[model samples]
Structure formats: C-alpha cells, structure tokens
Target: MALVKIIGCGNPLAGDDGVGLKVIEELKRWGLPPGVRLISAGLPGLTILDLMRGADQVIIVDAVEAGQKPGTVIHCKETDLARVTFRSLSLHNIGIAEALSLGRLVEPEAFPRRLDIVGVQIAEITWGKADLSPLVAAALPLAVHTVYNILKGGGPYA
Candidate 1:
C-alpha cells in the first residue's frame, strides 16, 4: 500500500469543475515518491472511499462552489471536510464528503489514516466540454504546489 494517495475528483465536461482533472494531468509529469500514488476520478465522487482505504494519507482535489473568486483555492483537513457546506459535485450523485462520513460511521477502521481536501473555486459549471476558465486555470500552479507540499509533509495547510 502507498504511504500517500492523491485522488483528483471532478467532471471534465463541467467547465472549471475539471480543475482537479487538470491538476492530475500535470502531476503525472512530476511523478511521486515510491510509496505515493496518483489517481483521477473524473467524477468518481463516492468511490473515493474505496480508493483511500488502507492509505496512510489521502489528498483529494476537486472544484467546489465556495463562492469565492473563480480561481480561489481552499484547504481542508478531515475535520474541516466534515463541516464543509457544498451540495455536491454536479457530476456526482453522492459526494466525497458524504461518502467519507458514511465510511467513518460504518467502518472506521477501513478509513485512511489522514484525509484532506483541496478545493478550487469554480467559475463556470455550465454543462459542456469546455476547458477551464482562465481564472481557474491560473490557479493550477499554486494548487499543484500545495499538493506537493502536502504530500511531502510540508505545506501551509499541513
């Protein structure tokens, strides 16, 4: 099992909501430590529970309707994730947050040792295969850096 897992969850067809997928694409170039794994959900929301099982730590990236600037990025730990207020990822029937919560209640021992969420503020969530908006696109680098730092056990949010 990997020491760390990074899962990008979002829908490519939903405009800026695809930022997580975009981050995953770039991260593939950077590679990871021997005990690290990277996976893209492409809207595999609740499935996150299974992906994170047995992992020491998990970092999830997704686009969220935080009502901030288009490119704004927000960091949240497991505790924060529980208190988060988002209806759901438009592409997902049930979201990661709900799934994680359910997993904790149903089989706490199967949960990851650590869980974190890095949400990027979405501008356009309209239905289409359009690329991310320029604002959200601009935040990609920072988001990448944040993820790197988090995985390495060194970051502002870590």
Candidate 2:
C-alpha cells in the first residue's frame, strides 16, 4: 500500500476551483518520495473512492465554499468535511459528506488510516473561467507547501 496518497480534485476550466489540480502540477515539479502518490482527480467527485484505495493516508485537495475569503486554505478533518462542501465539480456528483457516508457503509475497511482535506476557499466556480483570481493564484504556494509538510513529516494540522 502507498504510505500517503494525495488526490488533487478540481475543474481546471473553472477559475480558482482549479487550485487543487494546479497544486498537483507544482508537486510534480518537485521530486516526490517513494510510497507517496499524487493523483490529479479532475472533477472526480464520486470516483475519489477508487483513487483512495490502498493508501495508508489520503489527503484530498479541492475548492471549498466556506463563506471565507477566496484565498484561504483550510485543513479539514472528517467532521469539518461534513460542515463544508466542496465547490461542485459537476452537476450530478454528490457532496463529499455523502460520499464519505457511502464509503463507510460499502467499503469502510478499504479506507485509509488517515484522511485529511486541504481546501482552498473559492469565490466561485464558473465553468469557462479558465484563469484563477489573483488572490487564489497567490495562495497556491501556501497550499502546495501545506501538502508538502504533511507528506514530509505530518503537518501542524495532523
């Protein structure tokens, strides 16, 4: 099993919502350690379950609507995920909370030992707005660093 798996979820065509995938791209530039897998889960809201299998730890990075400023990065646990919803990656996909509930019922044993969410607060997720807003773009480094810290030595949030 992979020691840590990082799944970056988002729609690149949807402006700031793309920060998740962008962070994966940045991580790609740096050499990743063995047993650490990075997945660009673009719009894979429900399918995330499959990507999560076989990892000891799973870190999901995505856009979140938490009534906060656009660039804020929030590290969320299971309880926190229940209160915050990821910016809709698709019209048909269910929320992260529902997805986790399903996972618990259908395949709880397959879940990772540790699950964390690194969410970037977004103002909006317009389908055709291909560019991230200035604030969100500026926050990309911070988000990436957060993921790196967790992967390297269990970040403060951990």
Candidate 3:
C-alpha cells in the first residue's frame, strides 16, 4: 500500500467534467514520488473508499460545479469536503463529498488521515462530449501543478 494516493475522478465523455482524468493522463509522463500511487477512478462513487484504503493521505482531483468562473481551481480540505453538498442535475455518479463521508462511516481506521480535493470549476458537462471547454482546458496545468505541490510537501494539506 502506498503512503499517499492520488485519485482522479471524472468521465472523459462529459466535456469539461473530464478534467480530473485529463490531469491524470498528463501526470503519467512525470515519474511519481516513492510511496505514491496514482489512480484514474472514473466516476467512482462508493468505490473511492476501496481506492483510498491503506493510504495515509489522499488527494482527489475532480470537476466541480461551484458556480465559480470557468477554470477556477478550488482546494478543499477534508472538513471542507464534508461540508459540501453535491447537488447536480448531471447523470454523473455520487460525488467525492458523499463518498468520503460514507468511507469514514464504514471504516474510519482505513480512511486516509488527510484528504484534499482539487476542484476545477466546470463550464459544461454533457453526454457524447469528447473535448473540454477552453476555459476548463486552460485550468488543467494549474491543477496538475497544484497536485504536484501537494505531493512535494508544499501544498495546503502539507
């Protein structure tokens, strides 16, 4: 089991909603740190608990509809994620907030001690959409850097 786990959640077919997956794809080129595991968890609901088990810390990357400007990146800690109410009309799966809550309830000891969410404000999410909006696409590098910093011991969760 890794010490740190990075899970990217999204559906690649849903326009800008795929930012998390896209970031994971990009990260594949850079060698990851030791004791770090990367997972591209597409639309994972309760399965997030399984993926996070045994890790000391977890960083989740996902597209969020927080009504912020397109391409905005919001960093949320575990408490912040717990407070967020994920109400969306899209046909996406259960959100990170709910997943983490359930994980904590089910297995507190196996749950990660530190959880962070790097949410990129999404412009649109639709079925059969293959590409991201320009704004959301522009935020990809920023999200990647943010995650890298976290892994490097210099981000908010650090």
Candidate 4:
C-alpha cells in the first residue's frame, strides 16, 4: 500500500516560482521509493484530499517568495506552517498551507503522520514562461535529498 505522497504544486509559466514542477520532472528520472507516490498539482487543494485520502505521510514541494535569499530552502511542518505570518505568490485561492491545515482538521485520522513543505525561495516571479534561475535550478537535487531524508526520519535538520 502507498504510505506516502509527494505533491509538487506550482505554475510552470511563472519563472522560478515553478521550481516545484521542475523538481517533479527531475524526480521522475530518479524514480521513487516503494510505497511513495509522486504527483504534480496545479494548485488543487481540496481536490488533493481524495488523492491523499489515506496516506500515512505527505510532503509538499512548492516555490515560496518568503523574502529570503534566493534558492534558500525552508522546511516546515504543518503545525509550524500555520504560524507563518506572510504570504507568497501561491497558485491556489485559499493558500496551500491553509488548505492542508483545514484538511487535517476535516480528517485527522487520514492526515499524514508527517506533513512538510520544501519551499525554495525565489528572486523573481514573472508572468511569462522562462527556465528556472540557476540558483533555483541548483536547488533541485538538494530539495530532493531533503525530501528523501525527511521521509527516512533522519534528515540533517531532522
């Protein structure tokens, strides 16, 4: 049975903000561990409830313009995320962080044991399509490694 689900959410046309999707594509090449499911979402919040209806763990990869240095990676848990004081250029209407918290409230039992966001800080968010910045692009491997380590319960930060 699938025990974990990794959802990459972003808009590919929005410059470095699309890092999540890019990572998803790159992840395909590495393949995934057994019991782990990978999916790409274009800001579908509630809709994901079904896809992750009974997952034991969930990891969300998204681009966040949190005013930090570009390419900086911020890993935060679900509860900690609720304390965030600022917003980014999210593709969803209610915001992914709020959606996940509300999702957990609606189905506590079905909620993942671990819910983390692998956020990559972006320097620019443009309207038109463009490749990811070198900095953000360089972060994909580290982001993937971070997620893997988080899944294994032994990340450097963990």
How far in Å is the alpha carbon of 78 misplaced in model 4?
Answer: 0.7
Candidate 3 Cα deviation (angstroms), residue 3: 1.8
- The residue-by-residue lDDT of candidate 3 on 15-121, one tens digit each, is 88788888888788776878888899888888888998888999888888877788888776877653553222244467677667777888899887788888888
Estimate candidate 1's alpha-carbon lDDT, on a 0 to 1 scale: 0.80
> What TM-score should be assigned to candidate 2?
0.87
Instruction: List per-prediction Cα lDDT, in the order shown.
Output: 0.80, 0.78, 0.79, 0.76
- lDDT at 29 for candidate 4? 89
Tens-place lDDT per residue, model 1, 36-101, is 788998777567788887798889899988667788887778677646554346667777777778
Find the 10 residues in a row with the least total lDDT in model 3: 82-91
Worst 10 residues of 2 by lDDT: 83-92
- When sorted by TM-score, best at the front, the candidate numbers are 1, 3, 4, 2
Per-model RMSD to reference: 2.1, 2.4, 2.6, 2.2
- When summed lDDT is taken over every stretch of 10 residues in candidate 1, the lowest stretch is 81-90
Please identify model 2 stretches exceeding 4 Å from their true place. Answer: 83-92, 153-158
Cα deviation at 131, candidate 2, in Å, is: 1.4
Q: Is candidate 2 or candidate 3 better by lDDT?
A: 3
Clashes of each: 0, 0, 0, 0
**Residue lDDT tens for model 2, 46-102:** 688998888899888887777778888887666566455543334327756567668
Ranking by lDDT: 1, 3, 2, 4
Candidate 2 vs candidate 4, lDDT winner: 2
Off by over 4 Å in 3: 82-90, 155-158
